[model samples]
Target: MAYNVLSVIPARKGSKGIPRKNLRQLGEDPLVAHAIKKSKKSNWIDHVALTTDSQEIAQIGRQYGVDTIIDRPTRLATDEIPLAPVIEHAFEEVDHEFHYVLCFQPTAPLVSVDSIDEGIEAGIDSNADSVVFVRDSTHIYWRDGENGYEPVASDRKNRQQMDEIYQEIGIFLSENHIVRQGRRVGDSSEFYEVGMYEGIDIDTYADWILAESQLQRKQVLYRLIGNGNAGTGHVYRGITIADRLFEHDVLFAVEATEDLAIEKLEESNYDYQIFENEPSFLDYVRSTQPDVVANDILDTSAEYIKSLKEYTSRVVNFEDLGAGTDHADAVINALYEHSNPPENHYFGFKYFCLRNEFRYADPRTAIPSVERIMISFGGTDENNLTAKTLRALSDLDHELHLDVVLGLGYTDQGSLDSVTATYPPNISVEINQNVQSMAEHMEQADLLITSNGRTLYEAGSLNVPVISIAQNHREQKHPYAHISRGVLFLGQAEYVTEENVRTAVEEYVTEREKRETMREALEGHDITNGVERIKQIMFNQNNAD
Candidate 1:
């Protein structure tokens, strides 16, 4: 059977702490609207009514589709009047009878609808006379006496050893018959404990400011540690994920020597800070205390991960395959794979993080002949693979256009400039730096010669056939750069000769059937929705805690 429940929201114009507090805007809506909306959304609430002496408050309640409005008299609306008489007046004003009454205050706008419904269900299930919402309080007790100050309880005991104390948070539910007998709570009453953020009451100006700030977007910190040795894959990956998080206040944190990473952060116009060591970084983390810390520092140590856990609530690691994986809350390694990965670890091509531009671009169609070839080796090509690939392409007899994409950290610009100037009439060299339209370059090219990093996934998304060269030992073990996936993996850059690169380019240029087969294989993998999948994991981890 369904129980008839009535929810009442009382708003008065005589608030001494803050004038017109109920009608003032908190976030997007007034303070009183939150209470009315929560009551209307409750499944156990049969009807909702507003009791107020001010016409302005009554009009606002009508806009929220309240069932009825009880116009309180001047005598009963005074400061000395108790809540029991006001609830009794509202009960007599309504036309229909109710079995239970819920007294919700407009000041406590953080109370959830589920809590209200749960309180009603608890009162009906146990056949109790009253139900109240409470929150745990941890404070030292003290009292004033005729002599001086005295301790109310034992002051020697610690907080954990002390008994748990709960304080009522302005919400009261009682049987209608008991409320009519001039009692807010009867002898039999139960309590429902709520979280800290949910039981906040907006009585003072400071309290209102605190509630409004929480309703805004959450703060997120991206701790990206990328350099010449570690490569710039983590830097680019961190920026891509931060751009997609539009609902958060994203900031970048890097080391003092990571000039390339700092340049990219400034180019993207993001807020950032530079630290000297791990201890300084931990100090910054403790000072800010963000809701989540996105660590893109490659492999992390167990001690470093544990130190981060002390400052932040959640730690999300990207491309991590070290002892820290055992302690991290969530780990995402898209390039490498493990035989027995952890439960929170996400590996393989399914979680590849691509930029927004490449994910939304249309797939390119294969042409009959190879005309243009593109070369890109991440943001900081520490191995100087661009010069090596350009020299090999210059030795080719086939007349083709070369688009050499230089990174911001490329230091050997004079050597590349000399090679471009000494090119033959049949061969042309076009150097592009910090290009935003990388997908456009990939789409216009017949093939791409790059490293086994984020560019490999971007090229695959456009269905551009690639010839991947490992810049270091780490990229050699990357599973995504394989012949089955339309990529011709040419071992490492240090071992690959000029003749080997030229021979491989000639084979793909002459055989049209081989190029089409590679393009077809590249289209088989779905990498467009990897960002969404990773976001769901982070959000699930946040809600679980």
Candidate 2:
């Protein structure tokens, strides 16, 4: 427990999504600022440091008092560079002994300070090789091509029969878990279930849009995506999709911004460009013009894209920029589209759904349990619902676990803190950001009291009985869509009242048979193997020619 924890934030100059992503602003601060700030604030973290080759990113780290900047070499910054080696190289540079090495990406701007503390505590208390923070995604899977996505018996077996499945939410806590460490899967690593947003990363422009839009909840750029805030969502979503797609080289076109989201991208060290004007954007494309340019149009002007499309063979308008039906050859939707289609058409959620390869827990083993009420309203929740929901949950008569998700871009952490301090004995508050599989956590819960958005879809997919809360004007419009389809929507006709929220939970909780029915409906959702499906689409398209 008394060991030094070295926090390394890897950032490189070369990027494709938005130029200088690491140094880029996510709301008012840079992307790396979130992780660096969170690391600095964490009670368990001894020292917050950074690993980067970019002087700008290093300077920003310095601005935040993050002095440990490990200069990553060009060799390790390559597109083919595996993260393990990059992390190993940095740890090798450290001369002192450390208890835990927490590696976080600036992209995951919404990482919760409490979750970091929890992971560190778990790592020490469990006496495990590594206590990595992860969110369990039960509905997610990948096909081996044989099972065809049929639910694995291990997944469908009784709750007692299932094994917990965890993914390395880019944010990792390494406790000397390598080959030399001695133990399978990196020194008997244990998984910590953080909130859903923490699992987000930027892999493709579409994924980037999904992460940002989901958190902002307002149409900033496109109806699907939103203002550039946290870089983690963009980074995680992009990586997930790129990992799925086989042959396409994902390029990110980011405009210059003063937000932390951009810095996170720079830290990612992907092939990217920073555009200041239309001419520069066009020049960027013509210079290293990739086969396809996945535009992360956070603030990118239309003229730039219009011109680039003329010169480039294919410009896939990732739905990052407000509806681009008029601009590109193809549009990538992480939630709606699954497979590649003919020209003039695009893909969405279907493409990004969970793959079968990730199904670690059998459904049979999954117990019919509901304990916590998950409240996730992206970073910078334009609507301050975190405190409101906590107040409502505190009023509930039955024991309820309050799972609260905080975003780096969230401006109301102070308010959230105030709520946590006043919470009743039955209410438990968890401040989290980037987590692994969010679906698995949803699966464990009985009633989900959240806004009608991405998390709702995730809950629906997992058969987690949901009580949708309309936190904002946009949410108010269709609070009951999920409920009409069998998921409960709570805020229609008025902002979700505390009494109404409690009533909805009671209604869902008391009826065991109704909960079972909801679970069955969740079973019908097409299994999402976002990774494998993307792999098939990209590989097939890449090999088609």
**TM-scores for the candidates:** 0.63, 0.49
- Residue-level lDDT tens digits of model 2 in 1-545: 35578787777777777667777776567878888998899897776667787888888988988747788888988768767777777777766567678888777776678888888788788877776666665553455657466555434555445676665667777776451243213647888888776666665566556555544431111111223353244544554454444333455555566354455556656455556755676676677655555554433455656876666665554433354445665554443332455455444434443422234433322325556767776656666666666666666656668776665567667777876787678667777765555655555566666665556556655656566666555456442344334477655425566677666667666676777776676566554554465443332354211
- Looking at model 1, residue 372 earns an lDDT score of 95
Lowest lDDT 10-mer window, candidate 2?
217-226
Q: For candidate 1, lDDT tens digit of each residue in 94-209? A: 88888999998888888889888888898889898999888788667888978798877756588898888887788889899878998779789999888776788888999898
lDDT of 1 at 208: 93
Question: CA lDDT, every prediction?
Answer: 0.83, 0.60
Candidate 2 positional error at 145, Å: 46
Q: Tell me the lDDT of candidate 1.
A: 0.83
